[model samples]
Target: MRMTALSAVLALSVTAAAQSQPAAQALLDQGKWQEAASAGAALNTSAGLTLAAEATTAGASLVPDNQKKALFQKAQDYASAAIAKDRSNADAYFELARAQGRLAQFVGVFQSLGLAKDVKANLDKALELNPKMAGGYVALGLWNATLDSGGLKGAIAVQATGASRSNVAPNFEKAISLEPNTPIHRIEYANALLLQGKKAEAAAQLDKAVAMPAVTFWEKRDLEQAKATLAKLR
Candidate 1:
């Protein structure tokens, strides 16, 4: 009787953990980053940990540069934990890549360039696990574009990491095709174009991105960023 009762309690706990996921996501959708992170950290599952990582990384965007590296590292830790919980969680790998990209910004030239391997590997694994993940393609596009923007250093890094600007347009186009209505994809593509000094093309993409309807906090943030970037071009 005692064993059966304990098993029943364990099942209920598992069910509650699963049920808590959407609540955390609701906070994330509303841009309540801290709340979402806290809620996610309280749960034991990979999905919950992934949410915490996403929230931390997203929060890093709104912070000062001095503060961003720590947040990105925290997000990376959360993502790694999520992967430990479930290796097949595609989003965990994707979140790891995202955190790595942000963390790269806080390091020196060689260190930042070195991170390309980790970023690319996680992104590749994410896409391999879920071939149709548009965000993975968007990240790949950005990876190529950012690395190629480094001038001579970029060339060396490109050779070292095997990341080519040749891949940027195709990856971005794939992301745009997969998620045509996602403003972030358009905004990211414009960013890549700007890196290549294609001001006119960047402006066109920004125009389209700003005109799109934004339903989530992240989308709205991207829409505002697009507007700011376009204003600079004009």
Candidate 2:
């Protein structure tokens, strides 16, 4: 399935949090959900966005997928608090988008679609406020590509249109340039390429994504599945 940008934002938040081994691990071990949650809540500006992202990510990591709504709601609360403190905070918007996206994913609720759109608007505003915001573009591109690709329907669309995987190449390409190391972008792009019967190209992208030092074990496992699926096509 084509994962949404919201999913990427949430995943990125968690991944950023995991990078700080000691702090995140300590909070997790202590069951300091509130503190951890608070720490994430604090990342609302250019100066502290990274920190905030990591904290929320740590909190999200502790919450199971089935219980993600509650966790995301907490994240949203934090994000809202940050926004209240700084109305023009781009990072705050990103975090809010992440939380909403997680909630959307948890329930597959159509109402969540509007929330995702809201996220895109925030991201768009973030870019207008700061054009150098590479993360914003990456997140936006992921959301667009996922929706456009349409999962199994996207595959069928590809076949029906006879457009080839090359047709959807731009979205993934843009995403990669914005965040070359994010595994999701490559995997999603590879999926598109595979649908177009561009097996070798897809494999190459997936291989590179899998090999990234930053890719988590589970992400690597997913890449492996993409590779395995591609191999079958070959």
Candidate 3:
């Protein structure tokens, strides 16, 4: 009788938690990142917290460089809380990795390299839990490419973090295989190719990205960036 009662309570809680998600998602779809983050976090559930983290990260991306670090830190905190609430939250892991990777750019060399390990570990965990997570693969591709592109700093980071330039193309290829319609992935691939001095190959990717129709504000922004890069290549 006690177990049955507990199960019923859990089911009710889940249903209630799910009820608020659609409205929060609507805010995200509208690009109201800060509002979405707050709305999702209000639910006080793991999924809600993860959504909050995702929104917070998106907000961070749109902010000025001087203002981004705090938002990313907030995202990391939300994602950590979500993971504490539920160990199997794949999106939470991904968001944590995303925030960490972005945060790494603002830190000292040793700190950035250390954060790279955390970023990779979280991305690995996310993919382990949800193998179809194309975004995780894309992030990994950027991780490899970025850590290996900065001359002496790049070399030191690669040696310290075990990041491999060879892994960049494979990761982006896998991401595209899993989610070919996402324009940002191609743009990211182009950026990675440019880092490799494959300007022609990168231009090819930018061309593809330019041809894709934008479905969201973020996609449109990526397309604009790609177009500018393509123009430079031309």
Candidate 4:
């Protein structure tokens, strides 16, 4: 009887943890980044770790510049922890790449160059783990695009990270194909198109992004950026 009771309690605990996932996701979707991170503290699952990493990185943008590095570091730590827990967790690798990318943005060109390898490696690993991970493809596309746009610095970045301009559009298109409803992919691809001097094509993509419905906090923020960029293009 005692063993049976213990098993029942264990099952209930598992169910409760599973139920909390939606609430955690809702917090993230609503842009309650700090809250989402806090909520994820109690969860030990891969989803929870990904949420914590994403929330930490997103929350960094809302904080003072001085606090940004610390938050990004936390995001990287959480993502690394997730990977340690589950090497096959594609989202964990994606979050690691994202956190590193954001951290690179705050540092100097030389520092960012060093981080480029890590960013590219994690993104690649994420895609290897899950071929259908659209976000990973988008990040990889951005990596290629950003490095190729740097001129002399871009050449150096290309040497350091081994990223190529040739891979950019194809990866973006793959991302769009994998997740057609995701507006951010369109916006990012549009940015890539503009980098390539394909103004008309970029404008079309931005228009499509503006018309798409944003279901999450990140998507809404991306939508606003897309609208602002579209205005500049027109």
Candidate 1 lDDT, tens digit per residue, 33-96?
A: 9999999988968999999999999998888888999999999999999999999999999999
Give per-residue CA lDDT, model 3, range 42-136, as digits (tens). Answer: 98888888899989988887878999989889999999999999999999999999989888888887898889999999999999999999999
Number of backbone clashes in candidate 1: 0
> How many clashes show up in model 4?
0
Q: Assess every candidate by TM-score.
A: 0.93, 0.59, 0.91, 0.94
Stretches of candidate 1 off by over 4 Å are 1-11
Q: After superposition, how far is residue 37 of candidate 1 from its true place, in Å?
A: 0.9
lDDT of each: 0.92, 0.60, 0.90, 0.89
Worst 10 residues of 1 by lDDT: 148-157
lDDT of 4 by residue, 123-210 (tens): 8899999999999989999889888885788788888888888999899999999999889999999998887788899999999889
C-alpha lDDT of residue 10 in model 3: 100
Which candidate achieves the best TM-score against the true structure?
4
- How accurate locally is residue 59 in candidate 3, as Cα lDDT from 0 to 100? 87
Residue 228 accuracy (lDDT) in model 4:
93
lDDT of 2: 0.60
- Say which candidate scores most in lDDT: 1
lDDT of 1 at 53: 99
Better lDDT candidate (3, 4): 3
